[model samples]
Every structure is written in C-alpha cells, then in structure tokens.
Target: MPRQDDAGSESEHGKIPKSTFEIYRAEGDSQFRNKSFLKAIECYTQALEIKPGDQYCLVNRSKCYLNEGNIAKALADAEESLKEDAAFHKGIFQKAEVLYFKGDFENALVFYHRGHKLRPEMEEFRLGIQKAEEAINNSVGDPSVIKLRSDGDLSFFYAAEEKKKPAARSSYQKPKKEDSGPKRAQRNKAPADSKTIKKMLGDLYADREYLEKLLREESAKARKTEHSEKIQDLCIEGLNYLDSRSEFWQQQKPLYSRKKSAMREAAEKDKSSAAKYVIATLEEIDNKQTAGEHEAAIKQATRLLRTVEKWSPEDLQNREEIRANLHSLIGNSQFELERYDQALASHQADQKIGEEHELEESQARSRDNIGRVLAKQGNFSEAIQVWEQRLESSKSLSPMESTWLHHEISRCYLELKEFNKAKELAEKALSYANQMGDNQWLLNTNVLVAQCEVRLKNYASAAGNFDSALEHARIVDNALAIDAINRAIQDVNQKLVEEEKRLEEERQAGEQGEGDAKPDEAAGGEEQQQQQQQQQEQQEPVQQQQQE
Candidate 1:
C-alpha cells in the first residue's frame, strides 16, 4: 500500500517540477496537521495538479474535505484514490472514515473490515470497525438522533474520556497473609509468590524441573489428550519468561541456548510430519507464483528452505530430495524475476545434490533447467553442450523426451547458423514426434525444420514445411502457432519472389553483355584495316617532304 510514482519522467508541460510538487505537498501536510482544512485542501489540490494521480495528495485532500463537512468531495477523493490503487489500505480506511462521519455505518463497516483484512496490525481500522458497529446498533433504536462527529473532535473527546477512567492496581502489590484453614492456605501457596517465581525462572533456568513437575501433575489431573496441551503451555510460559528476563538480565546466552534447544527438540519430534507441512507450504508458494505474487512467493520459499535446513541430517526423512526440490523451486522463482545468476547457482546446487544422491530424473531435470538458463543468457554453445550431454547420458528416455532434446539441440544449431546440422536433427525430431503422436512436438519440429530450410535458402521446401506445420498447428487449435506459421509462410514467399527476381536480372545482364561484345569485335576489325591504310599514306607523305 506504499505510494510510488509510475515509471518514467513526466514531460515538462505535463507536470510541475518535482521540487515544486514536494514543497506544495509539505505545505499541505503542515496545514492538515494544523486543522486548517480549507488551506490544506488548496495546497493538496496544487500538489495534485503538479503531479496528477498522486495517491498521498488524494488521500490527504479527502481527509481535509471530510473534516470541513464536504462529504461529497471527501467521498469523491477517497474513491478516486482507491481506484488508482485498490489495495492501498490508507485510501480504504479514509473512505470508511468518510462513510462513518456521513452516518452510512453499514458501508463504513464493510470498508473498515476490508482495510483490516489488508492490514490487520493497524489499530485505527480496528477502532473504526468498533465505532461503526456501535453506530449501526445505536441507529437501530434511534436512527434519526445518531449524530456524526469529526475525527479531531472525536479524538479530543476520547482523550478526555480516557482521563476520566480509573487506573488499575499495580502488579507489584502482594496479598497479605490471612488466618485460614490448612486446605485454603495450601491452595493459596500453590500459586507461587513473585519472589519464588523469579527465583524459579532465574540464573541456571533451574526452575525448568519445577515447571515440568507442574505440567506432569496437571496432566495427571486432566484427560489424556490435554497432557500435550499442558506441556505446550508450560513451554510457552517458560520461553516467554526467559525472553522477558533477557531484556534486563546480563546473561542472555543461556536463554538463547534454551530457546534453540526447545526449537530443535520440537523439530526433531515432528520430522515425519514435516513432509506434509512442507508439501502444503510448497503448494501455497506455487499458488502465490501463479497469482503473480512473485516477490511474496520468493520470500515464502526462502523462509521454508531455511526452516527445512534447520532439521538435523538424521531427522530428515528424504533430505536430498527435499533440498533438491527447494533449490529448484527457488531457482524457478528467481528465473521469473530475471535474476539469472542466482537462478543458475540454485539450479547448479540442485544438480549437485541430485548427482550426489544418484537421482537420475532429478539430475536430468536440473540439467535441463541449467541448459534453459544458459540459453536465456544467450550462451547457446554451453546450452547445446549441456542438453546434448543429457541426451547422451539418458539411455531410458521416453520418445517424447528424446524428441524434445532433439528439438532443443536443433534450435541451438539454428541459432548458431549451422543450418545443415539443424535440418538433420529437426528431421529426426519430427520423425520421433510423429511416432510418439505428440502433435505439439510435431508442430514445433516442423517449424524448426522449416526455419533451417529458410537459412539454407531452400525457400520452396521451407514454405512446404511451414504449410505442414500450419496444418498441425490448426489441428491442435493453437492460435499463436497458427499465426506464427502464417507469418513464416508469407516471409518465405516474399524471399522466393525476391530470389527469382534477382536471378532473372542476372540472366538479362549476361545476355546484354554477350551482344555488346560481338558488336565491339566487328568494329575492332574495321578500325584495324583503316589504320593500316593510313600508315601507308603517312609513309608516302614523309618521303615527298624529304625530297622537297
């Protein structure tokens, strides 16, 4: 619910300067705190104009308007702020507050509960709900007489009312010893004095024995099922006492050690049950991811992994399997966030664990993930090598799996411009896909084969392969695949036409050159005869000149 500006800088004409906006917003806050509602509204309006859609300004203005008795404006501002961010608890609370003052207790209660659901720790929402419910109940008896009060007046009234309330006695006071029967005295002594309680929870934590004894006695007096509950209560009490004392006591190491030991014992006792808990937690994490709550999913998965790591090696039923799965889950979450290095590290850890445990399927999956991450990083060579090694090592691969690996390898080859290799692998993949009757794989392999043909300049063959791919895509009802195939077909057709046009132009240029060469040869022979006759005439002229 924290307010944040949308990405990108606003144009000069679209927004006031950031510094100016901040100044106005600050002035608005000052006026709001001073109860100058009208001035506050003006300042907030200026801020909003400077940076329109500012959630904080909207919420503040709503509060000002509500305080100034302008219910319509208050409601409008509150609703607008919520429309900008429905999950903003402040806006939800503001809307609820406005409704409460407007005497619309029913609607107020609804938004109050919504705000509470969003942020359970906010005391204002709890108080608001209490007040709203009270108003609703009171209105049932005297609907017309129910009056509304501003938040400021209400706050002052509550303060005055609190001062009028009586204070309770101190915890330090002790009861005086009284003359009573032996049985009554014994009952009074059972609840230990403060000194005894302090001594019992002090230094060596020596009172642990006394606490356990009490638990045992309590269990003996209760039903069998209640024994565990008694024990849990005793442990909680002891831990709480230790925590309280540690704040003032110098020696906290023992307290911390005790807490740690308690946690470890509980974890060891529930190791078997941990699997079901872990499975449920993992499913929740997956749900978060599917809901696009990536950040929350990452945090939950991380905490779960840490908790799992706390279990001793001997306590875990399937240690390596749990570790591998958790690491893979973390890697997937990280990958979604585009944190490639962290994802690679996580996948590698999973792969190492799988290899150490001799879990072939897990190891293969980890390797596949590693390859995928590598490919995403544009490390095609490494990705191809990893996948190829996996394919070679996997002797028991199903036809579909083999086809997938072939398709992956061919894709890498295509990226590397090794068209012939790509074509070869794609064809093999297509055959396996057809044999396995996997329409999706068949469509993908066909597209890959067509791509390779295009890279090799076999336009007609590429177009035909794409046509087959398009047909398969149609059968599968994959609109994206159909669209991609159609576009590929158009591209191939365009390339074919361009190629034919280029060839025809080259052929015409060759024919024209041949004709020009024949004419030049004939002209050359005529020019040589004329030059010889001219040379004879020049020799005669030279002789006549010499005689003269």
Candidate 2:
C-alpha cells in the first residue's frame, strides 16, 4: 500500500492500502509481463480477495497457475472466471485445456467441440480435438503390452527389471549388475549412444555442413527445453536474427548457418575446408567468452572442453583460450563447491597463461586467486601483505578496490591480533568502496571494522560498531557477517570477564600487603619524623603542584 502525507499531490489509489483490487490488478499485470509467475500469483490472489469478479485478474491468474503446472487451481480459476463472464473465449479455452490435461477427455471433447463451433478456424482448438480422439483410440491398448518394441517384443519385463536395478550416483562409478550399459552415459563418461556423438554446446558452431545441421537441431531442442524461446528459434531463423544487432535471442544460430554457408561456398572438396571455417568460428566465440560475456561463454566452454578432450594434452596447440576457459569453468565450479585448493590451482593455470601472454587482467586475477586460497587456509598475514602490496603498486584499485582484497586482508589482521591495522585499513577501504557505489561491499568493510574493535578488547567501542554493522548486514541479509557478529558477541563477553578477574586479583594483593604492615616502627618514629620533615620541606612545592 502507498501512503499519502496529507497532500493531494498523492494519487487517489495511493491511500487505498495493500491487497486492494486496484493495487493487485496493477502489480499482477506488471509481474505477468515480467514473466514472474510466482509473483503474479501473490498479486492475483490479492485482487481476487478484494474484487472477486475482476475478469482480467482471474484470466491472468489462470495463466500463471497453468505455467506453474498447478492444474487443479487452473481448472478452478477457468470455471470461476467463466461464471464471472460467460462470454469470455479465453476462459472457455482454459477450461477445455485443463479438462484435457486432467484426462477428462469426454467433457474436454464436448468443450472443444463447442469452442470450435464458435471459432471454427482456430487450428489450436482443432488440435485439441485431434489429441482427445487420439487418447480415446490409444485407450484400448493393454497396460502390460503398451510399450511393445519395434520387433513387437514386450518391454515391460525388461523395463521393470531396469527399474529395480540400483543406479550408480557417483559420476566416476559403474552401474550395478542387471545391465546393458547406459544409452546416455553419465557426465565424465564417453557419449553413451555413440562415442562419436559429442554434445553440441549452446554457442559452439560446427562448420561441416552435416555436423552443423545436426548440432543446430540438438541445440534448438536444448534451448526449447531450457525455456529460452528466442535462442531456440535461432537454428532456423539464423540470418534474420544475425542481421539485427538487437536480436541476440538466436546468436548461436550464426555459428551453424553462417559458418556452414561460408565453408560450403569456399570449397566442399575436403574436410580441411570445414576445419578452417570451424577454427575461424571458434576464434570469434573465444573472444566473446574471454570478454566476460556470459550467454555465449556457456556455449563456448562446453565446446572448448570437448575440443581439448579430443586432442591429447601434449598435442593441443594455439587453443590457449580453450584451455583458459576450461580452467575458468573448473575454478568457478570448485569455488562454488568450496574446494578452495583445487579452485586456486585451476585459476592459476588460466591466470598463468594470461600473464605469460601479457594479459594484465589475467595477472590481476592470479593475484586474486592467490588471495582467495590463502585466506581460506587462514594465512591472513601473507594474504593481507600480498594485497597491500598490490593496492600500493596499482595506481587505483581495480574495479572498485576488488572488495575481496580489502575485506580478506582485514579479516586476516583481526585474526592475527592486529586490530588497529585492520580497523584503519577497513575504514580506508570503505571510503573508496562507497565512491564506486558498491554499497553492499562498502557495508561489509564497516562490519570488518566492527569485528576489529571487538578483537582489540574495546568492548564499549565495539557495541556501537556492532549495532551499526548488524543493521547494515540485516538490510543486505549478509549471512557471513551475521554469523560473524553472533560469534563476536560471545567472544567479547568472555574476554571482558577474564580481564576484570585479572584486575581484581591484582587489587586484592595490594590491599593484603598493606593490611599486614607491622607497628614495631614506633621506636624509629622519632628518627623517621625528622627525615620525613626534611623530605616534605623539599617536596612541598611539587606536592602543591600535584594537588592543583
């Protein structure tokens, strides 16, 4: 709900409050267009509660439910919507489709026939009738004999046997006994159907005419499976999409048609003709991958990984890029898995090539890799020292102080009992980090400073710092920082108790010594008084100054 501050400048609907018909209608429309079906549900549910007869809300809500495969809710919605507006064609269509999907073909056929009678030229409705008839026809087959093979042998016995067999979940393991080997071997295995049939990656282009055609077909199907409508159509609509700078939906299409056309036009005489074309296409794809372009990188990485696998490690050449990207994928996957050592190694492999080949970004990345691995191992001193050198040597922080450098180094110092240094550095990091508008990362620096204060045993100072850190971390909902603070609170409390105990012990010892003093000094008092009077005369001005 939007609130108005006693000003007419606010919209009439502003003060209508949340869950109102107008609010839900607006939000539902926006979220539906944005393809957020779950969010649209929230909005539609709101509108339906407020205005039960909102035609637009019900119809759209039905669409969201259908998309989410909630067939029951979709059926209820379609029926309820038709009750609201009997003449609505979309609702009628939805009702028929829901009935069909639910296998109530008898009622479905009746609804489809009625819909078709009203709108006869609709091919989709006609298809629905055909599907209903086909289901009715197929219903006569025996359940046990339904899956007879091409040779007319019953498959249920074999299929049931396979189902009972245990699958090998580990990628590296062999399947359990009952078996024929897999038709599509698990990842890390050779292609299950045929060793020659390698996977076509999303963007990888096959230059050979036949190979390109097959790869494009598979890629198109894959894109469709992934629900990427635009990219899927690219295989057939290559030229149309490739010509338009904005039509990136089918960018992978160019790899098939364009490369094949070029290879076909150049010479169809030899495999080398296609190989040369493939090399050219690969180079273009590699450039996009290296530039941090993600959509194409996924495609490029799979292709590159397979290409490297085809060649013996020693025989591979000039595909420094292929190796680099494979390593990048390995490193990223390992990083996600928290296999820091393996991740660092893979990152270094790529980073090493980029550096040896004079790539500055690669060198910076290598340094970042070293920092990640070292910090994970709790070698904060070296990691901090390394990043400080990098920060000093560079004219300006690369890409917003590379937040990890500042944050990781600070964490190290806090761990190593170097509180002042950590707090000072973390604060400095926040100054530069905020200017770059990386607000969350900047907030992280504040949290690090708070952590340092806690480590320094400055409890009075730390409480306020921790409060601010908690507020910011809550806004970001940063899990790591929240966990750190919970631990910090416990840690600081223990340290405070220990310090107070030590101070009280020392104070008690001083009092005990004073209480044990002897009174035998009375005899010597006369001599002592004469000496003390002389000392007092000498120290009187100093004592006065001390009193003042």
Candidate 3:
C-alpha cells in the first residue's frame, strides 16, 4: 500500500485507484433493488473482476439477468456460481427458476427440491417447489392447461421476493484461495444417496400394488358407476406416479396389462352384467360429451371398445350391437372435437358393421354422418351423392326427418354453387317445415333460400328472406341465429348499394359517349369529302399531261 486512500487504492506493479469488491457488490445490490438490471450487471462485473470466485455476486447477477429476460446468461451465471460453491442454495434456486420459466417443470421440481433440502428456511425455494409441483400436476393430468411460452406470463414463476445481500466489510478483502480438495472429494459420491433411492423405489412399488388392488376391486364391483370411478381413480394415480426412466415404474407395466386382462375376463364371465356395464359406460361417455368434455369422452369410448374386443365369442351376447354403439359414440365424440379424420374412420367402421347386419336405421344414420363429414371437408359433390342415396333408401320417413334431409341436400348444393338446385330443394324443405309447424327448420330453410337468392343476384328477394329468417330466429330466442341473419341482411344491403352505384356510373358513361360521338361522326364525313376532291384534282392533272 504505497498510498492508502478512502476508495481502497492498491499498488502492485503500478498505482491505481480501485474500489473494494464490497463497494462494487453493494452498488450492484442497490441497482438490482431499483430494477436497473443493466447497471446492476455492470457493477457485478466489476465486483467479479476484483474477486472472481465470489459466489454471492455471481448468484445475485444471475437474478439480475433473469429479471432482464436473459435466460441463457442467467443460467450461465448460476452454473458458474454453483461451480464456485456446490452447496449454494441461491444458485440452485436460480437454476430451477430458469427451468420453470422454460416449461421444464419436471426437472425444475428436482432442482427446487434439492435447493429446498439445502436451505429449508428459504421461503423462495419452498414456493418454487410448490409452483413446480403444480405445473407438473397440470402437465400430467391435462396438458392443454399448460400455458405456452409465448403467453407472456412467466412472471408467475418469478414471483419470489428478491433476496437480501450480506453485510459489507469496511475494508478491502483479499480473494480467497480456491478449494479443490473438498469439491473433488464430494464429486466421487453418488448422485443420489442409497437410502433415498431405496425409498423412491419402495414408494413406486407400493403405489403400483395399490393401483393393482384397486383394479381388482373395480372388476369385482357389479355397479358400473362405482367400477368406472375406481378405474378412473387408478388411472389418475398411475399417471401421477409414472416415470419412464425408473426401473420400478417399468416393472409396473405388466401389472397394468394384467389388471386390464382381469377386468375383461370378469366382464366376459357374466354376459348380462357385462351388457349392463357397457350401457353404463356408454351413458358416462354421453354425459362427458354433453358436458363438453370431448377428449374425456373419446378416451372412455376407446377403452370400452378395447374391452369389447377382448370378449369371448360365446360371451358376446350382443357383440355386434355393442361394437356398433361404441363405434358410433366414438364417431360422435370425435366429430364434436373436430377430429374429422378419426371421426370419419369410426363412422366408416360403424357403417360396415351396419351393412353386414342389414340394419337399415343404423345404415341410414351412418350415411348421414359420412355425408356430414364430407360436407365439412368441402367435398360437396360426394356429400350430395351420399345424401341422395340415403334419401332414396328411406321411403317412409317422418315429415320432419324428410325436411331435415332435404335441408342437408340443399346445403350441399349451396356449397357446390348450384343455386337453382339449392333454391328448389330449399323451397321444398320449407313447405315440409311449414306443414310440420317447426320454427327451427323454418328458420334454417329460410336462410338457405336467402343464400340462394343472394347467389342469384336477386337482392330484394334475398333481403325479404333474410328478414323472415331473422323474425323466426327472434321468435326462437336464438341470439346466434339472429346475429347471423342480421349480418346477411347487411351484406345484401351492401351489395344492393354497390349494384345501384355501378348502374348509375354506366348510365352517365353512356350519355357522355353519345355526346362525344355526334361531333366525331360529322368531322369524319367532312374529312372523307375533302379526301375525294383532292383525288379528283390529282387525276385531272394526270389526264391533261397525257393529252399534251
């Protein structure tokens, strides 16, 4: 210390003014508290230059980087801090925060638990563990609930309070020597302790056994509701404990298969009870569908189908009927979910079963479903053919059913741009709807007619039809239909205005053209006469020259 100063100037090879590491670190802490992340980073960098292995400074700067949305830099700082001190709780927590923000809740939970174990009193670590667990639960139970990265709400995982800094020293402190011996010794230990590993394995086995017992109980139950509930609970528990990497979890695979087989065997042993169970399961699927749980409905229908497939030939008292019902249920659920390809496949399977059994009603229903799918896919020509075939096959139908079929065919024709055909079918459907006095079909048929009229460029007729449709929609108290008809009316009015403007512009252009053409025709006649006189004069000159 050639000249000691208040700012802690040091001289080794040359004298220079330099603040102590504590002062720079304190400045960083102040900036960080004020939310000045860039300035905090600058101060932390200066502190690190003075004391390169300061874990506290590195961890604090990692937090600053995280606040600035620099995830990679934050992770780098956290990793370096952990390298300096492997037991650094703040560094571990920061690493977990980065993982949580990245939507790796499983790994985040691991790191958070590790940090919590090291620092039990830290509220941030505990909160992080809780959040990571919640995220993991959502991902396991319903993946759709997980927020996307672009959802702009990563602050939920970052809601922990900022950590307080340690008390600063009054004087400059020398950098401590690196400790490699202890770190190297610790590195030789196993990643997880033997006791913890054994506990994890034991817990996994216990859960698996419990699930297997539940499945057995479920198969023994005669009540379908109780049995379905038990199976559903087993599925949830299995999902909660499932881990692909664990040997214990992998061992549970055959147990799950055996449980499924047992359930199937029990159902097949009693055909009457099994039929009742199938009906109950179908009712459950329908309830799910009605509740807008389309995904759950689809899963239940698939499971029922699998169970039906496992039934013995003799045990299948109503095998064809049950299979057809399951297929139809799956198709309806998939359709509600807008999974068109899967729905189409299920409907086709149902149709084949119906055809083999010669069930006319089922066949007609399948054809209708197929036509609906085709129309949704914009294959209107094929949809029309299918609907026409259905129409031809059904000779004796209720007035409402026939009206609905005509309406369906008219919709196809409208999509295909066949306005004349659409109008004819729509009018016929309207007549049937009027005879039945059904307001809903009347509204639909009226809209179809309005659409056809718009396509035919009959704006007044289209407007009248839309008005009638709107009145019917209002009478039925269907706000959505009312809005649709209102929009149609507005569109027709817009088209009418455009047409009138176009006609007026054409009339003006024609009048201007006529006025301009009269003068042009007179000038053309005068020019023609002048050209003839000039030609005669030239010919007379030639004749005189010849006579001479």
TM-score of each: 0.46, 0.38, 0.43
Candidate 3 clash pair list: none
The TM-score of candidate 2 is 0.38
Report the C-alpha lDDT of model 1 over 15-109, residue by residue, as the tens digit: 52444677789889999888798998988887887777788998899988876656656777887786656889988898887766554556777
Order of quality (TM-score): 1, 3, 2
| lDDT at residue 81 of model 2 (Cα atoms) | 74
Q: Look at candidate 2 and tell me the lDDT of residue 279.
A: 58
lDDT of each: 0.65, 0.53, 0.65
Better of 1 and 3 by lDDT: 1
**Ten residues in sequence with the least summed lDDT for candidate 2:** 154-163
In terms of lDDT, model 2 sits at 0.53
lDDT score, candidate 3, position 369:
84
Which ranges of candidate 2 are over 4 A from the true structure?
1-323, 338-341, 392-395, 436-439, 477-525, 529-548
Off by over 4 Å in 1: 1-271, 508-548
